[model samples]
Target: MEVSKRFEQAINKLYNAFHNDTLHPECCKQCAVGNILDGKDSWKHLSDNHGATTLNYLGQVHQNLGRTFNGYSPIELLHIEATFLKGCGYIIPLHHKNKRPKHVTDKDVLFLGLTAVVSYLCELDKRHDVMDCTTLFNYCNVIKQVSLLS
Candidate 1:
Protein backbone atom coordinates (compact mmCIF):
# COMPACT_ATOMS: atom_id res chain seq x y z
CA MET A 1 0.00 0.00 0.00
CA GLU A 2 1.35 3.37 -0.94
CA VAL A 3 1.33 5.78 1.92
CA SER A 4 0.08 9.27 1.27
CA LYS A 5 2.43 12.18 1.89
CA ARG A 6 0.56 13.14 5.04
CA PHE A 7 0.71 9.61 6.37
CA GLU A 8 4.41 9.47 5.69
CA GLN A 9 4.86 12.74 7.52
CA ALA A 10 2.90 11.42 10.46
CA ILE A 11 5.06 8.31 10.57
CA ASN A 12 8.20 10.44 10.53
CA LYS A 13 6.89 12.57 13.37
CA LEU A 14 6.17 9.53 15.51
CA TYR A 15 9.52 7.95 14.65
CA ASN A 16 11.34 11.13 15.66
CA ALA A 17 9.37 11.38 18.88
CA PHE A 18 10.26 7.80 19.83
CA HIS A 19 13.92 8.22 18.90
CA ASN A 20 14.20 11.51 20.76
CA ASP A 21 12.48 10.08 23.82
CA THR A 22 9.83 12.80 23.62
CA LEU A 23 6.78 10.53 24.05
CA HIS A 24 5.43 10.59 27.60
CA PRO A 25 5.54 7.09 29.00
CA GLU A 26 4.98 8.23 32.58
CA CYS A 27 1.87 10.11 31.56
CA CYS A 28 0.42 6.99 29.92
CA LYS A 29 0.37 5.19 33.27
CA GLN A 30 -2.05 7.83 34.49
CA CYS A 31 -4.08 8.04 31.28
CA ALA A 32 -7.83 7.58 31.26
CA VAL A 33 -7.82 4.64 28.88
CA GLY A 34 -4.93 3.01 30.70
CA ASN A 35 -7.09 2.79 33.79
CA ILE A 36 -10.43 2.50 32.00
CA LEU A 37 -10.88 -1.15 32.95
CA ASP A 38 -9.50 -0.58 36.43
CA GLY A 39 -12.59 1.37 37.57
CA LYS A 40 -10.60 3.91 39.48
CA ASP A 41 -12.40 6.88 37.98
CA SER A 42 -15.50 7.62 35.98
CA TRP A 43 -14.89 8.05 32.27
CA LYS A 44 -15.94 11.68 32.38
CA HIS A 45 -13.78 12.40 35.39
CA LEU A 46 -10.77 10.68 33.91
CA SER A 47 -11.15 12.52 30.63
CA ASP A 48 -11.52 15.81 32.42
CA ASN A 49 -8.55 15.26 34.70
CA HIS A 50 -5.99 14.23 32.12
CA GLY A 51 -5.34 17.38 30.11
CA ALA A 52 -3.39 17.47 26.86
CA THR A 53 -1.96 14.01 27.34
CA THR A 54 -1.45 11.45 24.62
CA LEU A 55 -4.45 9.50 25.80
CA ASN A 56 -6.53 12.62 25.76
CA TYR A 57 -5.49 13.23 22.20
CA LEU A 58 -6.44 9.69 21.33
CA GLY A 59 -9.83 10.12 22.95
CA GLN A 60 -10.39 13.25 20.96
CA VAL A 61 -9.49 11.34 17.83
CA HIS A 62 -12.02 8.66 18.70
CA GLN A 63 -14.67 11.28 19.20
CA ASN A 64 -13.91 12.93 15.90
CA LEU A 65 -13.93 9.61 14.09
CA GLY A 66 -16.99 8.29 15.87
CA ARG A 67 -15.03 5.15 16.55
CA THR A 68 -14.46 3.49 19.87
CA PHE A 69 -13.90 0.04 21.31
CA ASN A 70 -17.58 -0.25 22.15
CA GLY A 71 -18.53 -2.20 19.03
CA TYR A 72 -15.14 -3.75 18.30
CA SER A 73 -14.31 -7.36 19.04
CA PRO A 74 -12.25 -8.06 22.16
CA ILE A 75 -9.21 -9.06 20.13
CA GLU A 76 -9.43 -5.91 18.02
CA LEU A 77 -9.66 -3.75 21.11
CA LEU A 78 -6.68 -5.57 22.61
CA HIS A 79 -4.64 -4.98 19.48
CA ILE A 80 -5.46 -1.28 19.52
CA GLU A 81 -4.69 -0.97 23.22
CA ALA A 82 -1.48 -2.96 22.91
CA THR A 83 -0.32 -0.80 20.04
CA PHE A 84 -1.08 2.34 22.01
CA LEU A 85 0.67 1.04 25.12
CA LYS A 86 3.74 -0.18 23.28
CA GLY A 87 3.98 3.12 21.45
CA CYS A 88 3.92 4.84 24.81
CA GLY A 89 6.92 2.80 25.94
CA TYR A 90 5.19 -0.03 27.74
CA ILE A 91 7.58 -2.93 27.41
CA ILE A 92 6.27 -6.45 27.23
CA PRO A 93 7.43 -8.79 29.97
CA LEU A 94 9.86 -11.45 28.89
CA HIS A 95 9.76 -15.13 29.91
CA HIS A 96 12.11 -14.65 32.85
CA LYS A 97 10.81 -13.13 36.03
CA ASN A 98 11.88 -9.55 36.74
CA LYS A 99 13.80 -9.57 33.51
CA ARG A 100 13.24 -7.20 30.62
CA PRO A 101 15.06 -7.01 27.34
CA LYS A 102 17.72 -4.32 27.48
CA HIS A 103 17.16 -3.14 23.94
CA VAL A 104 14.43 -2.95 21.35
CA THR A 105 15.72 -2.65 17.83
CA ASP A 106 15.24 0.72 16.12
CA LYS A 107 13.24 -1.00 13.42
CA ASP A 108 10.88 -2.39 16.01
CA VAL A 109 10.39 1.02 17.51
CA LEU A 110 9.77 2.43 14.05
CA PHE A 111 7.13 -0.21 13.41
CA LEU A 112 5.42 0.52 16.70
CA GLY A 113 5.61 4.24 16.18
CA LEU A 114 4.29 3.94 12.66
CA THR A 115 1.40 1.85 13.89
CA ALA A 116 0.48 4.59 16.32
CA VAL A 117 0.77 7.40 13.81
CA VAL A 118 -1.33 5.56 11.27
CA SER A 119 -3.95 4.87 13.89
CA TYR A 120 -4.21 8.55 14.67
CA LEU A 121 -4.31 9.48 11.01
CA CYS A 122 -7.08 6.99 10.46
CA GLU A 123 -9.21 9.00 12.83
CA LEU A 124 -7.92 12.42 11.97
CA ASP A 125 -8.78 11.91 8.36
CA LYS A 126 -12.42 11.71 9.32
CA ARG A 127 -12.47 15.30 10.46
CA HIS A 128 -9.95 17.05 8.25
CA ASP A 129 -11.24 15.80 4.90
CA VAL A 130 -7.71 15.93 3.51
CA MET A 131 -6.82 12.30 2.94
CA ASP A 132 -8.54 9.67 0.84
CA CYS A 133 -10.10 7.05 3.08
CA THR A 134 -9.06 4.22 0.85
CA THR A 135 -5.45 5.39 0.68
CA LEU A 136 -5.26 5.92 4.41
CA PHE A 137 -6.82 2.56 5.18
CA ASN A 138 -4.49 0.84 2.78
CA TYR A 139 -1.50 2.58 4.30
CA CYS A 140 -2.64 1.61 7.79
CA ASN A 141 -3.07 -1.99 6.65
CA VAL A 142 0.46 -1.95 5.29
CA ILE A 143 1.75 -0.59 8.55
CA LYS A 144 0.00 -3.41 10.41
CA GLN A 145 1.56 -5.95 8.10
CA VAL A 146 5.01 -4.48 8.61
CA SER A 147 4.48 -4.44 12.34
CA LEU A 148 3.56 -8.13 12.29
CA LEU A 149 6.39 -9.02 9.96
CA SER A 150 8.85 -7.34 12.28
Candidate 2:
Protein backbone atom coordinates (compact mmCIF):
# COMPACT_ATOMS: atom_id res chain seq x y z
CA MET A 1 0.00 0.00 0.00
CA GLU A 2 2.96 2.27 0.28
CA VAL A 3 3.60 4.82 -2.38
CA SER A 4 7.14 4.97 -3.67
CA LYS A 5 9.37 7.94 -2.81
CA ARG A 6 9.92 8.49 -6.49
CA PHE A 7 6.21 8.80 -7.03
CA GLU A 8 5.78 11.20 -4.14
CA GLN A 9 8.67 13.34 -5.30
CA ALA A 10 7.41 13.49 -8.83
CA ILE A 11 3.86 14.45 -7.92
CA ASN A 12 4.72 16.87 -5.14
CA LYS A 13 7.37 18.67 -7.13
CA LEU A 14 5.06 19.00 -10.09
CA TYR A 15 2.06 20.05 -8.03
CA ASN A 16 3.97 22.61 -6.01
CA ALA A 17 5.76 24.01 -9.02
CA PHE A 18 2.47 24.52 -10.77
CA HIS A 19 0.35 25.67 -7.84
CA ASN A 20 2.36 26.80 -4.84
CA ASP A 21 4.96 28.74 -6.78
CA THR A 22 6.05 29.43 -10.31
CA LEU A 23 9.49 28.09 -9.76
CA HIS A 24 10.16 26.35 -13.05
CA PRO A 25 10.39 28.46 -16.14
CA GLU A 26 10.18 25.60 -18.59
CA CYS A 27 7.35 24.05 -16.65
CA CYS A 28 5.54 27.32 -15.95
CA LYS A 29 4.78 30.09 -18.41
CA GLN A 30 3.25 33.51 -18.12
CA CYS A 31 1.13 33.07 -21.24
CA ALA A 32 -0.87 30.53 -23.24
CA VAL A 33 1.97 30.17 -25.77
CA GLY A 34 3.67 27.50 -23.71
CA ASN A 35 0.47 25.56 -23.07
CA ILE A 36 -0.45 25.74 -26.69
CA LEU A 37 2.95 24.30 -27.47
CA ASP A 38 2.49 21.65 -24.81
CA GLY A 39 -0.94 20.79 -26.16
CA LYS A 40 0.62 20.27 -29.53
CA ASP A 41 2.95 17.68 -28.09
CA SER A 42 1.91 14.23 -26.91
CA TRP A 43 1.78 13.67 -23.17
CA LYS A 44 4.73 11.30 -23.33
CA HIS A 45 6.72 13.91 -25.16
CA LEU A 46 5.66 16.61 -22.76
CA SER A 47 6.52 14.65 -19.62
CA ASP A 48 10.09 14.42 -20.79
CA ASN A 49 10.29 18.16 -20.29
CA HIS A 50 9.81 17.71 -16.54
CA GLY A 51 12.82 17.58 -14.29
CA ALA A 52 14.23 19.02 -11.05
CA THR A 53 15.98 21.77 -12.95
CA THR A 54 12.72 22.62 -14.59
CA LEU A 55 11.64 23.95 -11.20
CA ASN A 56 14.49 26.38 -10.92
CA TYR A 57 13.71 28.36 -14.03
CA LEU A 58 13.33 32.12 -14.20
CA GLY A 59 9.81 33.07 -15.33
CA GLN A 60 6.55 31.56 -14.11
CA VAL A 61 6.13 28.08 -15.56
CA HIS A 62 2.76 27.26 -14.05
CA GLN A 63 1.23 29.49 -16.66
CA ASN A 64 3.01 27.39 -19.27
CA LEU A 65 1.15 24.38 -17.90
CA GLY A 66 -2.15 25.91 -18.94
CA ARG A 67 -3.26 26.90 -15.46
CA THR A 68 -4.97 30.27 -15.19
CA PHE A 69 -6.70 31.00 -11.90
CA ASN A 70 -9.05 33.39 -13.59
CA GLY A 71 -10.12 31.03 -16.34
CA TYR A 72 -9.13 27.48 -15.39
CA SER A 73 -10.49 25.21 -12.66
CA PRO A 74 -8.84 22.61 -10.43
CA ILE A 75 -11.01 19.77 -11.72
CA GLU A 76 -9.39 20.17 -15.10
CA LEU A 77 -6.01 19.15 -13.67
CA LEU A 78 -7.58 15.94 -12.31
CA HIS A 79 -8.90 15.18 -15.76
CA ILE A 80 -5.48 15.86 -17.20
CA GLU A 81 -3.77 13.54 -14.72
CA ALA A 82 -6.38 10.85 -15.30
CA THR A 83 -5.77 11.11 -19.00
CA PHE A 84 -2.04 10.97 -18.48
CA LEU A 85 -2.33 7.86 -16.28
CA LYS A 86 -4.48 6.27 -18.89
CA GLY A 87 -1.86 7.08 -21.48
CA CYS A 88 0.76 5.57 -19.19
CA GLY A 89 -1.26 2.33 -19.09
CA TYR A 90 -1.98 2.64 -15.36
CA ILE A 91 -5.76 2.75 -15.64
CA ILE A 92 -7.53 -0.22 -17.14
CA PRO A 93 -10.38 0.29 -19.51
CA LEU A 94 -13.90 -0.36 -18.30
CA HIS A 95 -15.87 -2.76 -20.50
CA HIS A 96 -19.44 -1.95 -19.50
CA LYS A 97 -20.95 1.34 -20.52
CA ASN A 98 -23.73 1.71 -17.96
CA LYS A 99 -23.47 -0.45 -14.85
CA ARG A 100 -20.17 -0.57 -12.98
CA PRO A 101 -18.10 -3.70 -13.09
CA LYS A 102 -16.12 -5.44 -10.34
CA HIS A 103 -13.18 -6.14 -12.58
CA VAL A 104 -10.82 -3.70 -10.85
CA THR A 105 -8.92 -5.44 -8.06
CA ASP A 106 -8.18 -4.06 -4.58
CA LYS A 107 -4.63 -3.22 -5.56
CA ASP A 108 -5.88 -1.35 -8.56
CA VAL A 109 -8.29 0.61 -6.40
CA LEU A 110 -5.56 1.56 -3.96
CA PHE A 111 -3.24 2.64 -6.74
CA LEU A 112 -6.02 4.73 -8.24
CA GLY A 113 -6.93 6.23 -4.89
CA LEU A 114 -3.37 7.36 -4.33
CA THR A 115 -3.15 8.73 -7.81
CA ALA A 116 -6.47 10.48 -7.28
CA VAL A 117 -5.20 12.14 -4.14
CA VAL A 118 -2.17 13.42 -5.99
CA SER A 119 -4.35 14.51 -8.87
CA TYR A 120 -6.70 16.35 -6.52
CA LEU A 121 -3.77 18.16 -5.01
CA CYS A 122 -2.63 19.14 -8.47
CA GLU A 123 -6.13 20.40 -9.19
CA LEU A 124 -6.09 22.49 -6.04
CA ASP A 125 -2.90 24.07 -7.30
CA LYS A 126 -4.58 25.13 -10.52
CA ARG A 127 -7.54 26.83 -8.88
CA HIS A 128 -5.79 28.97 -6.30
CA ASP A 129 -3.70 31.97 -7.29
CA VAL A 130 -1.51 32.16 -4.20
CA MET A 131 -0.80 29.44 -1.64
CA ASP A 132 1.76 28.96 1.08
CA CYS A 133 4.51 26.64 -0.09
CA THR A 134 4.55 25.09 3.36
CA THR A 135 0.87 24.24 3.09
CA LEU A 136 1.31 22.52 -0.23
CA PHE A 137 4.46 20.73 0.85
CA ASN A 138 2.82 19.56 4.08
CA TYR A 139 -0.23 18.26 2.28
CA CYS A 140 1.85 16.23 -0.14
CA ASN A 141 4.22 15.08 2.55
CA VAL A 142 1.38 13.90 4.78
CA ILE A 143 -0.19 11.77 2.07
CA LYS A 144 3.16 10.40 1.04
CA GLN A 145 3.96 9.51 4.64
CA VAL A 146 0.58 7.85 5.06
CA SER A 147 1.30 5.80 1.99
CA LEU A 148 4.40 4.51 3.74
CA LEU A 149 2.27 3.30 6.65
CA SER A 150 0.13 1.16 4.45
Candidate 3:
Protein backbone atom coordinates (compact mmCIF):
# COMPACT_ATOMS: atom_id res chain seq x y z
CA MET A 1 0.00 0.00 0.00
CA GLU A 2 0.95 3.64 -0.27
CA VAL A 3 2.87 4.92 2.78
CA SER A 4 3.53 8.49 3.81
CA LYS A 5 6.94 9.98 3.17
CA ARG A 6 7.61 10.13 6.89
CA PHE A 7 6.73 6.46 7.31
CA GLU A 8 9.02 5.53 4.44
CA GLN A 9 11.91 7.46 5.92
CA ALA A 10 11.34 6.11 9.40
CA ILE A 11 11.12 2.51 8.18
CA ASN A 12 14.30 2.88 6.19
CA LYS A 13 16.19 4.29 9.15
CA LEU A 14 14.87 1.57 11.43
CA TYR A 15 15.82 -1.14 8.93
CA ASN A 16 19.37 0.14 8.67
CA ALA A 17 19.76 0.46 12.42
CA PHE A 18 18.40 -3.04 12.97
CA HIS A 19 20.89 -4.57 10.56
CA ASN A 20 23.78 -2.41 11.73
CA ASP A 21 23.43 -3.35 15.40
CA THR A 22 22.59 0.23 16.37
CA LEU A 23 19.03 -0.33 17.61
CA HIS A 24 18.96 -0.53 21.40
CA PRO A 25 15.85 -0.47 23.55
CA GLU A 26 17.60 1.08 26.53
CA CYS A 27 19.06 4.00 24.59
CA CYS A 28 17.06 7.05 23.58
CA LYS A 29 19.27 7.77 20.59
CA GLN A 30 18.94 4.24 19.35
CA CYS A 31 15.40 3.47 20.41
CA ALA A 32 12.47 3.13 18.00
CA VAL A 33 11.41 6.80 18.04
CA GLY A 34 15.00 7.93 18.08
CA ASN A 35 15.83 5.88 15.00
CA ILE A 36 12.68 7.13 13.30
CA LEU A 37 13.73 10.68 14.11
CA ASP A 38 17.14 10.04 12.60
CA GLY A 39 18.88 9.08 15.81
CA LYS A 40 17.90 12.23 17.68
CA ASP A 41 17.50 12.11 21.45
CA SER A 42 15.32 15.18 21.79
CA TRP A 43 12.21 13.03 21.83
CA LYS A 44 13.21 11.80 25.28
CA HIS A 45 12.15 15.11 26.73
CA LEU A 46 8.53 14.32 25.91
CA SER A 47 8.23 12.01 28.88
CA ASP A 48 9.42 12.15 32.44
CA ASN A 49 10.88 8.66 32.32
CA HIS A 50 12.12 6.22 29.77
CA GLY A 51 9.53 3.73 28.48
CA ALA A 52 6.72 5.89 29.78
CA THR A 53 3.60 6.15 27.64
CA THR A 54 2.30 9.21 29.44
CA LEU A 55 3.30 12.68 28.38
CA ASN A 56 4.80 15.12 30.87
CA TYR A 57 4.03 18.83 31.12
CA LEU A 58 6.25 19.75 28.20
CA GLY A 59 4.92 16.87 26.18
CA GLN A 60 1.33 17.82 26.95
CA VAL A 61 2.04 21.36 25.85
CA HIS A 62 3.49 20.15 22.60
CA GLN A 63 0.58 17.84 22.03
CA ASN A 64 -1.83 20.67 22.74
CA LEU A 65 0.10 22.94 20.41
CA GLY A 66 -0.24 20.36 17.63
CA ARG A 67 3.49 19.86 17.51
CA THR A 68 4.78 16.81 15.75
CA PHE A 69 8.21 15.27 15.66
CA ASN A 70 8.99 13.87 12.24
CA GLY A 71 5.24 13.78 11.54
CA TYR A 72 4.36 12.02 14.81
CA SER A 73 2.63 13.70 17.71
CA PRO A 74 4.16 13.55 21.17
CA ILE A 75 1.56 11.02 22.25
CA GLU A 76 2.32 8.83 19.26
CA LEU A 77 6.04 8.93 19.99
CA LEU A 78 5.46 7.86 23.56
CA HIS A 79 3.25 5.01 22.35
CA ILE A 80 5.89 3.96 19.86
CA GLU A 81 8.59 3.86 22.50
CA ALA A 82 6.40 1.99 24.96
CA THR A 83 5.34 -0.51 22.30
CA PHE A 84 8.97 -1.02 21.35
CA LEU A 85 10.11 -1.62 24.90
CA LYS A 86 7.25 -4.02 25.53
CA GLY A 87 8.11 -5.92 22.36
CA CYS A 88 11.70 -6.11 23.62
CA GLY A 89 10.33 -7.90 26.71
CA TYR A 90 10.65 -5.04 29.12
CA ILE A 91 8.15 -3.84 31.67
CA ILE A 92 6.75 -0.32 31.31
CA PRO A 93 8.52 2.77 32.61
CA LEU A 94 11.93 1.28 32.06
CA HIS A 95 14.06 0.88 35.12
CA HIS A 96 16.69 -1.36 36.62
CA LYS A 97 13.91 -2.56 38.85
CA ASN A 98 11.62 -3.55 35.97
CA LYS A 99 11.83 -6.84 34.16
CA ARG A 100 13.81 -6.74 30.92
CA PRO A 101 15.51 -8.99 28.49
CA LYS A 102 18.60 -10.70 29.74
CA HIS A 103 20.59 -9.72 26.65
CA VAL A 104 19.48 -6.25 25.55
CA THR A 105 21.52 -6.22 22.39
CA ASP A 106 20.75 -9.63 21.04
CA LYS A 107 19.79 -9.57 17.36
CA ASP A 108 16.79 -11.78 17.92
CA VAL A 109 15.62 -9.59 20.75
CA LEU A 110 15.85 -6.43 18.67
CA PHE A 111 14.02 -8.15 15.82
CA LEU A 112 11.10 -8.89 18.09
CA GLY A 113 10.93 -5.25 19.04
CA LEU A 114 11.10 -4.18 15.42
CA THR A 115 8.26 -6.47 14.50
CA ALA A 116 6.05 -4.93 17.14
CA VAL A 117 7.01 -1.44 16.09
CA VAL A 118 6.21 -2.16 12.50
CA SER A 119 2.80 -3.53 13.39
CA TYR A 120 2.03 -0.48 15.50
CA LEU A 121 3.18 1.77 12.69
CA CYS A 122 0.88 0.06 10.27
CA GLU A 123 -1.98 0.43 12.69
CA LEU A 124 -1.21 4.09 13.13
CA ASP A 125 -1.03 4.62 9.40
CA LYS A 126 -4.15 2.54 8.65
CA ARG A 127 -2.21 0.19 6.42
CA HIS A 128 -1.81 -3.54 6.18
CA ASP A 129 0.88 -5.12 8.32
CA VAL A 130 4.10 -5.59 6.43
CA MET A 131 5.13 -8.48 8.64
CA ASP A 132 1.80 -10.26 8.68
CA CYS A 133 1.61 -13.98 8.02
CA THR A 134 -2.12 -14.00 7.31
CA THR A 135 -1.42 -14.35 3.63
CA LEU A 136 0.42 -17.56 4.34
CA PHE A 137 -2.60 -18.79 6.21
CA ASN A 138 -4.75 -17.88 3.20
CA TYR A 139 -2.44 -19.85 0.98
CA CYS A 140 -2.80 -22.82 3.23
CA ASN A 141 -6.55 -22.44 3.04
CA VAL A 142 -6.33 -22.45 -0.74
CA ILE A 143 -4.30 -25.64 -0.63
CA LYS A 144 -6.86 -27.21 1.64
CA GLN A 145 -9.61 -26.28 -0.80
CA VAL A 146 -7.67 -27.91 -3.62
CA SER A 147 -7.12 -31.02 -1.60
CA LEU A 148 -10.79 -31.21 -0.76
CA LEU A 149 -11.65 -30.81 -4.43
CA SER A 150 -9.19 -33.58 -5.34
Top-TM-score structure, candidate number? 3
Task: Write model 3 residue lDDT over 59-108, tens digit each, in one string.
Answer: 99999999998989999999999999999999989988999999999998
Write the candidate numbers in order of decreasing lDDT: 3, 1, 2
How close is every model to the real structure, measured as TM-score? 0.29, 0.20, 0.90
List runs of model 3 lying over 4 Å from the truth.
139-150
Model 3 score (lDDT):
0.92
For lDDT, candidate 1 versus 3, the one ahead is: 3
The weakest ten consecutive residues by lDDT in model 3 span 1-10
Which order, best to worst by TM-score?
Answer: 3, 1, 2
Q: Report lDDT (Cα) of residue 150, candidate 1.
A: 100
State which candidate, 1 or 2, has the greater lDDT.
1
User: Against the hidden true structure, what lDDT does model 2 obtain?
Assistant: 0.36
lDDT of 2 by residue, 42-139 (tens): 22122223211122222135535655432332233324443333423343222224232143223343244334445554444544323236576678
Error of 3 at 149 (Å): 17
Q: After superposition, how far is residue 86 of candidate 1 from its true place, in Å?
A: 4.6
